[model samples]
Target: MLRGAWLGLLLTLMATPAVATSMNAFRERAVTDPHGLIDAVRQQLDQAGIELPPARERELLWGMGTAAINSNDDAALAEATLRLDGLATVANDPVAAAAAGFLRARHDIANGVGDGLGEALKAADKVLGESDPEIVAWARFQLCDAYALDEKPAKALPLCRQAVTAYRALNDDYGIGDAENDVGIALATMDRVDDAAATYERSRQYFARAKAEQLVVMVGDNLAQMYLKQGRAREALALSRASLKQELATGRISDALNSSADIARAEAALGRHREAYEQMRKVVAQARTAGINGQLVDMLKVESRLAEQAGDLRQALADEREAARLGSAVDTPALRAIEVELEQRYAAREKELRISELEHANELKDLQLKAAEADAARRREQQQRQRLVNTTIALLAAALLLIVGLLALLLRAQRRHAAELQAQTLRDPLTGMANRRAFQQRATELLGSPREANAAPHVLLLIDIDHFKCINDSIGHLQGDRVLRLLTDYLRTAVYDCCFVARIGGEEFAVLCPQAGLAAGMRLAETLRAGVAALVLPQDLPVARLTISIGVAQFDGTRCHDLSSWMRAADLALYSAKSGGRDRVEASKLAG
Candidate 1:
């Protein structure tokens, strides 16, 4: 029996290279024109005049199966998988039969849930019993994949680790790397984020050492996606862009689309809004053309957000509507029926689980309730004894109130008088504005401080009534006071939501404009300048016209230039304005 088996194996080994060459040729052709290659292979196999050995015939069927899978033509795959399965079964080749069965099972699962997962497991077990370590590792990987697809990654992870160990024992670096990549994905889904990233890096290093460019590209993309989830946008952006350029050069359109999507997200994070929008547009178009409903739905939603960032609300809404439409259209009648069946099964299972949990909870609650009842009986006796003491305490408190009432009134009057005296000191007395001390204190609180991301930068505007002494001497002091009040009204009105407005000194007012920066401050100063210039000061006031010189200072978003420094900058700029003949807006070097 051993001699016979050795002879059979010799013959099979001699025939293997020719069969493999044919399969490889067909695979290469299928990459560019899968349907044409499929049709040509089918025609050759169907020809009655052609005679081929069994091994070569099996190779043709396997090639056709792979091509069909690549084409996403389910019917063709079904036909090829069935023929390969029957031929391998009769040929008594466990390896060939296992591979054919596994492919068919994966195809079934890819389309929807199928009955062949058990069969796939059985085939994998047969392969595991074989002597080839590499083949056993591959079978273990397939088993891991089955568990992963069933949403049991924790079960799959041990198998994945075992596969990696087996591959390492055989010095199969490529196999080890691919298995580790699988392990990383499982870990990531298990929420071990740091472990997943480290595993991915290890896999990437192995692929790089092996000079497997395609595998390296795949690993790089996976790592970049992980970085995005970690909020490391800059790193993700760099890796994605580099990999995308390489993938595009290699004609990997699908991979390029995925990379482009990643690039969009990173660019948006980096504030390259328009570039991000363009990248997302290309991704949407490619996904739409590919007729990939899930990718299309995802890309459209991303595109909608990009549009919103670009301030194109109409386009954003339209994209959202289209995404919604596509999402609804993805649920075909068959898929909808399957979903409904799953939902029903889930509900029934959940109801049973809830009942079991509730029964357990009720037993615990009953024990606690019995304990509480004993405690409550003891508390009732204590409550009855405390009631008699409460009435005695209330009578004593009423008798003490009469003794303290007059003293409380006199103390309240003195406190009121002192509070009024303190208010009078902080007041400007003339224009009802905050005095200089109060102005400086309030300005220090609002300005000269770092602002939050959503908060406004602080701006300080210093106003000097141009030639105020002239106005006071030429017009009486009352008229000058009226002019100051007129300017005060403009300052309060303009700087209401602008934070603080005060008269820091006579004829010099300060307004702390929170959240306003250079351009905003300049515009405001120009407005206040224009507004005061345009003011008639009322025909009743002694002054015919009023003009003001102003200086503006704003925080540079770093160290808060203390209020004094900010004031000095504005004061210097104010001096420049005065020296340059007044009634103008000027920004300090710090402002620029």
Candidate 2:
């Protein structure tokens, strides 16, 4: 890890100045649409000579860091920020320092480190004053964000307002829309609800005009949260459902999770308690899987409240215990306050119980002074003891039942883990599709079967993304991953029930068709090509305009050979298609 870090630092130092320029270019593209800006800068970086000058190389790295930050990937953001920091320290360029400082600041913000805040704001201020209108706008917006996170919303809100003004002056609709959202966030923090709502509404309109569905979903969620806080649960529910539907329709998993949480909150408010509890449970489950301790804590709060309201005391206690466990992880002030409150409540209850016990003892002594009353008390005590014994037995039985249930759950969970591990071994993480090993193994087994020579042949088409590495390097790996996932979904639905698809390499995918001829395979390839070409990516990606190249080949009958030969032919055809301007399919000749 140390070696890798040092190497990353060296690389960053060498590329700092160039990365600054690239970041500036990225800012310009962002004025049209920050998300789209990633692709635009990527295209520019691609068009530039592959061998970049030191300055350009640094700029490209900065651009990649920016894209990673936008994608909300903290680990990637931290690595990129560290690299940028190393570059800034060695590079004399002021612009390089400014860009690097901004990235470092964002990383610090995410990690809860305050030291980077002042430096970031200072660098952003300098950049805003010295740069062109677009760069100034971008820097100012980021500066506001840093300030807000640093607990200096007083400074942040005005900067965000300024960014909005600048974008409006420039007549940049997309920039204005993004800035409007920022402004609304700042205003909301200041408790300027009316102004914030209006600002968000304006932002929503601009997003609509830009046809930016992702932006729409974001702003809608914010507005819904505001409504929920203001006791407008009905409005919140409507907005949340609408936003969730939009996110789900667009296949935005991360955004969908956010909307799902909002929907759960709204459901709780609407008195659909059972549904709300289930939804919150799912959110908690997902949060645990994702390793987001903070979200897990919040989800536990939801569960605790739901259980309390539903009169499930044991479940409520369990929820609170989970919350405490996750709370101890991050050590936030929110958790501390909750811990104190619970302790105080417990103390108060203990005192009340002590007083009640004393009063009951006094009443028992007074009753024993009267013989008739004492006789009745003796009979009642005997009856009570008998009932207690029966209750104890029942409780023991229930405990045994619970133990059995817990064991069953544990066994099921173990089995599930094993299945998941096995599946992961045979699947690609990026695309959630089959892996090369699985594909080859299946093909080998089929080939070894006792089928006749004239049995139906399986066609294999190797699909490669043209210039995939360039895409990843330029736009950031997150976007590249998104593209891969999008392609996988398209492949899954491209044909009928006769196809098997897998991502066999980083950018190489394969489709296997059972019982299909060369002619039929070629047609499938054409259909896939056309279908993928027509498919739109969820967010604004510049490369959505590009296309996939496919190489087609088929398994031979009476040959128990490895599948590599067919794979190689398909790869060659794919290469030919890419070499011939991409966006098309190529077929291999019959086996020699």
Candidate 3:
């Protein structure tokens, strides 16, 4: 036995009751012999009988259930979880109940993957608020896992941080290290890889100091994997080899085989390809011997990659083919799904327990009179499970409805944002008027509008600011902008909203009048020409005056020419006006 107060005290319990003795042995095994504890507990449970099953299950579940959850072994957790739930029900021990509830929540998370996270959170909260400090610390550790499973790293990180404070308050190194390990998981999930690596290192130190070698191995694997990710392959290889050597010495074939793969990866990273190949070959051989198909398939893949790198094409191809054959032959998903379905319902159990108390209060009186306490407890357990199923169904339906509502809101907001963006795209930034694109679109809409044959004629006015370049050269573009704004003010006042005004290009504006003919068009053009001619400017302007040349073109629906040809005709007319004189309106002559 190790020279330690706790271990020595447990060593004194060798002649105690089987459950009592097994617990101390289990505690000792947890620190020193990770692989032996499960069988030890099972043997203890068998020897002790039904009366000792609850305590046996409770302690074993905490120690072993944790390893199962950590390893993501759904089968072990599912089996342990069922037995723990039974124990919690019959024993009515708060610590056992809390452990069962929290472990069940972990089972729920692992089973659903993500679907049962909300329920996991509720279960975690239930146990975290328990009166037992050790139980509370353990619940907090599992709560951290729940948040990670929830895919909310931000939420998980803060909870782990708070758990560290709580664990420190209890002065428990094991709890503190577990809390730190969770913090590393959260940090890794958030892609704070370097910080996660450092946190894992700190956690390993604590676990090692507390003489928890299993935890040290677990944390060592995590840190080594992180180091490999960061390309610190030499360090990762050294650390994994040391930890793996210890696992092998303890005869933990499973843990050793698992770590061997990681060490192989580290070797590959360090460019020791042949060494990596041999290490993974060892892993594949062990996996085959053990007949663990999941491990076999993964190890074979790793071996194949290593063999390929080592130029052993025949061996690589053989492993690859075998892996594929086994993978296809195995129908794992169906079995896994069945397990998941059984495992995912633990969250609502807490709610069911509370509700069952009130619903069976009167029944409890009759059961007491009949003196069937176990029967009453069994009845309550069954009722609680049934009610839990009902509540889970209702909650899932409400979640579906809420998701539909949120999706609808998201789509509505997306459409509104698109509309606002579209509007901004079509407007001129400087002039605060429609751009050419908006003008063309609106004109297309209006001309395509349904109208009688006798509908009023429409026209296009192409207006150019005359002597604008001289103004810019004399006073600068800033004053020219002021002059353009002034002229815009005049155009707005004269033609107003009835006509669409667009600044198509530099100092070139277009007006589209839908209800105006040649006569009305000429009048609007003359008004616009006279309005610009009468514009006043600041004394700082080079030329103290501004004017515009206008070209008015009437639509010939009979000819039905494109807008570009129409603009061409108006452009010719504008050239004629500039030749005729500045600040004048000209009409395009139609070809018969």
Provide the TM-score for each candidate, comma-separated.
Answer: 0.42, 0.44, 0.44
Give the alpha carbon lDDT tens digit for every residue of 1-592 in model 2: 0001111111121111333453343432222233453555456657875565656655665765665544445554465556556656666555666777777765554433334455565565444334466566666666666655444557667676776666654555656676677666667777777777787788889767766555665677768877877889998788778876765554333445667788888888889888887887787677566554434565677778877776777888998998787555545576446535643554465466658865696566445335444454555455556764877655655555565556556656865787799888998877778898888877777666675455456788889877788889988998888888888888887764546787788888888876566788899999988988888666677575547899987777423145767777777778788889998899876432
Candidate 3 has its poorest 10 consecutive residues by lDDT at: 1-10
Whole-model Cα lDDT of every candidate shown, in order: 0.66, 0.64, 0.66
Query: Could you tell me how far off, in angstroms, the CA of residue 541 lies in candidate 1 after the best superposition?
Result: 91
Model 1: CA > 4 A from native: 1-83, 92-94, 104-131, 146-152, 245-253, 293-592
Candidate 2's error at 436, in angstroms? 79
TM-score of 2: 0.44
Instruction: Give model 2's clash tally.
Output: 6
- Total clashes for model 1: 2
Tens-place lDDT per residue, model 3, 1-592, is: 0001111111111111433513222333544454465556567667777666555556666565544443344565576667776776777755555555556654544333223344445445455335555455555555666665445678777767767766655555666676787778778778788998999888878778777766676667768878888988988888788767776665545556668898899889888999999888878888677555545676788899999999999999999999888665533566446434533444455566667764586465445444543444455455556764877655655555565556556656865787688878798777777888888888788777765455457788999988788888877999888877777777777774457888887888889987567787888899888867776766665676688999888777654366767778788788888899878899997511
Cα deviation of 195, candidate 1, in Å: 1.8
Backbone clash count for every predicted candidate, in the order shown: 2, 6, 0
Off by over 4 Å in 2: 1-50, 53-59, 70-75, 86-91, 107-119, 122-129, 149-152, 230-235, 245-254, 293-304, 312-592
Residue-wise C-alpha lDDT for candidate 1, range 1-592, written one tens digit per residue: 0000101011111112322422223433433344776787788788833465555666666666655654556677688777767767777766667667666655543333343345456556455446665456656766665444433468768877877766555555566676777777677778777887898888878767756555566567667767877989999888888777865654444456667888898899889999999889888888677554545666788899999999888989999999788656544576546544643553465466658765686577556555655555555455546766766545544443433444456555765787688778777889888878887787767654555565446777888989999988988788889888889888877664535788988899877776666777788889989999998668777676788888887875443357767888888878887877988777776654
